[model samples]
Target: MTRLSRWLGTAGALALAGLATPALAAGTQAGTTITNTVTVNYQVGGVAQNAQTASDTFTVDRKINVTVAEVGNATIVVSPGQSQAVLTYSVTNLSNATLDFALTTAQQTGGAGAHSNTDNFDTTNAKIYVDTNGNGVWDAGDTLVTYLDELAADGTKTVFVLSDIPLGRATNDVAVVTLTATGREGGGAGAMGAALVQTAGANTSAMDTVFADGAGATDAARDAAFSARDDYTVSAAALTVTKVSKIISDPVNGTTNPKMIPGATVEYCITVANAAGGAAANNVALTDVLPTTTTYLSSFGILMNGTVTGAACNADGAAGGTFASGAVSGTLASVAAGAARTMLFRVTIN
Candidate 1:
């Protein structure tokens, strides 16, 4: 037998002897060692053939080499105007062996700013999850948050929790998230055993563990390398309206006093400018909305020229013009970005 096998057999014999000892409760140190060996046998048909083989054996002593290193104190802060608080925590592996951990929260009690134990905060239900499945999408079934596979020696990982409570609730709505690390020295299979060892590799390396470690393993370090949530408040300022000035020009100036005569046509020009800091588009209809003193006339034709070119205006000796009912309808196109246009109207009043 190999030296490892002999050691294991001896240890097993001692364990049986220890059970019969009366001093077992006195804390007598028991040394244990284990050995593993592989054997292979092969045979060929036709002629009877037999083979026996044994591989080398290796031994291991059972001992615990555990080291715990904390990345730093975690913190969760909320912007003043926001209703949710974001929590960020970090844990580091100081042991030579890898570590697997799970983080869970417990409410604070019997403190100045203590809060009642309630399920108000759920990390899984939050808008931002760790994307555990690597599918680039978040799903309802993937709600279990805060998990770490293998954190190598000198490595670290960060966990995030989003809370629904507002920031101003209790000044310090404190809670504790326990980070339970489990594994064996030199990167053993841990509690997950050999199956996980084959699938995730012998090393205790996980996706988030590598990500946080590469980002420097500290909460502050990771946060500095990325962007955190931001809060904002939006509101309207003010609204106002102001009137500027109006312009009027008579196109039909005549030598006769009270220039317009009955049955005579005249043209009037009206120009309105927008003098405000902002711009506005207006399609103001130029309806006479005539007074009772004025009489309705014939078709009020428009003149595109600089001078009057129509007989639609009244030759009656009057200062203003008149038009038939529903005499004009046209679009003003569009007002220039910051300019003005003049509209001309021709009519006759009796």
Candidate 2:
């Protein structure tokens, strides 16, 4: 066809504008083919001629982006010696292509946690798992995975950090942990892909890699990884016991400034105190074996949950306890934090 006006060659084609535009705000899917075609109209000697057309195509590059965010707003409260305490998180694949995300965890070394609580301890036996059931809670059916597999673009998965609280952790002690998700190549099933590398220079016909992730709690921006922090706080019962004895009466003194001697009545006060800022101690049980030199006062039985006045236990408690096998035993039901309760019993010197 004879053309009245001719278009530029490869140079003009390469300079074409608006040939490919981002399809979504997140990003166009990787490997998506975008084709641009232009047609030229011409006339020869006042006669219409066939149109000539040129087209160019390119694949959308992959944009690696992901986010790891803590799932809850508060620190997880746990007890001393508690096992399998959980800190939940979410990993979102915000890239234009499916990706495998490598997961890792770090314990904060004495700093503020995500909840702004001081991190004073480290958890033991920490492990990561994926919420295979989408229940948002870690369970036996959930799969333990080191990396998220075949997560598609715009997909999100719940993650869990399971750890054990040490036996001696104090109340209100905090242990902070961070979770990071690094993007990698996807497409292979049940296998982890290689790490992603950003394509240098300019665009190309083949799909390239681009890092679009922002900085996280523990990772730098554009590193193809994101991180978030969570914390475990201890809420344990700190208990202390104290025992004191007082002579109420003797056969010779008759309850007037009595002294410790044979046939004297000795009252034993056992006080159990729980420190403040700790959890309540429940089902508290106490037992004491009487000394061989003392005879059990079966008529007095025992006083439980008694009031302590002036460093001495008053007889204001309910009649509760058992005396058998030369020992006294009772249960205090519950003792709240920062509170003290006493169990009182009497014995006569043999």
Candidate 3:
């Protein structure tokens, strides 16, 4: 027989010896005859001692049980930024056995679409979720942070809140995470006890949970509630310029050009205007830089009119007389806002 079988066989023989010894012994008393009472118990033995021999058989049953302790609460922190808040959640496992958990967030009901699983949570199986709305609690459709695979007894796990949830969404924005412990085989026997068998398929039901405050209760939730207050304002408009018109005479009306052989002369009129929004200062001057192609004419003169005043001239006038050979400069004297002025000049073309 194998070692295990030999050990069992020895134990069975010992038990039989103990049971049969008393029945086989008999003694006589001093004054009376002695009587012996005996009982026989039969069993099915593995090996027969002789032909028509009997043996003994016994049955043994065993079972195993597994239990999990409670899980510790989690703390969540959120950072401030324009795009999204970065949330961090820390949790601890208090159970003697390893545990598995998943994290999920509340969802928003109206307006824009919901947050996608890949975008919000780090993993699909079990994870942390950031209630982007900052309502202080999780609603359906919120983001999932991701799962923490396995946490050993008294171990801790941390999850990151990658994005900032906007403020001004409804209240109760929250960050949530769930940790679950699955019932598994333990030390003892081949069959499992009540606890393990009962939770066989619904392993996730033994989850430990944590949640943020109600809407507007936590910092994250308050920030989301007042997001609209941080908005900015902008304005715009158009600019325009007005046109000026005037006439110029080819020759002076009553003067002759001294440089020409005949009585030829030229007169030209020009208009100027302040097309911009502001007024033109009196000291702001106008100039006509004479070109090499133009010839000087002594009979020429310039006349000023309109909003500007100061210098005016006739053919023999002192203030403005004969065309200069080169440069010419003069001030507008004054020009009202959005107003126009005119000046006339007479000279032979030459």
Q: lDDT for every model?
A: 0.35, 0.87, 0.34
lDDT of 3 by residue, 229-256 (tens): 0111011111122222222333444332
Ranking by lDDT: 2, 1, 3
Q: What's the lDDT for residue 72 in model 1?
A: 30
Model 2 residue runs over 4 Å out of place are 1-25, 42-48
Candidate 1 has what TM-score?
Answer: 0.26
- List TM-score per model, in order: 0.26, 0.88, 0.23
Mind giving the per-residue lDDT tens digits that candidate 1 earns over 322-347? 34564432334334333444445554
Candidate 2 residue-wise lDDT, 41-119, digit = tens: 7899999899887765667788888988888778899999999999999999999888999999999999788887899
Q: Worst lDDT window (10 residues) for model 1?
A: 230-239
Candidate 2: deviation at residue 105, Å? 1.4
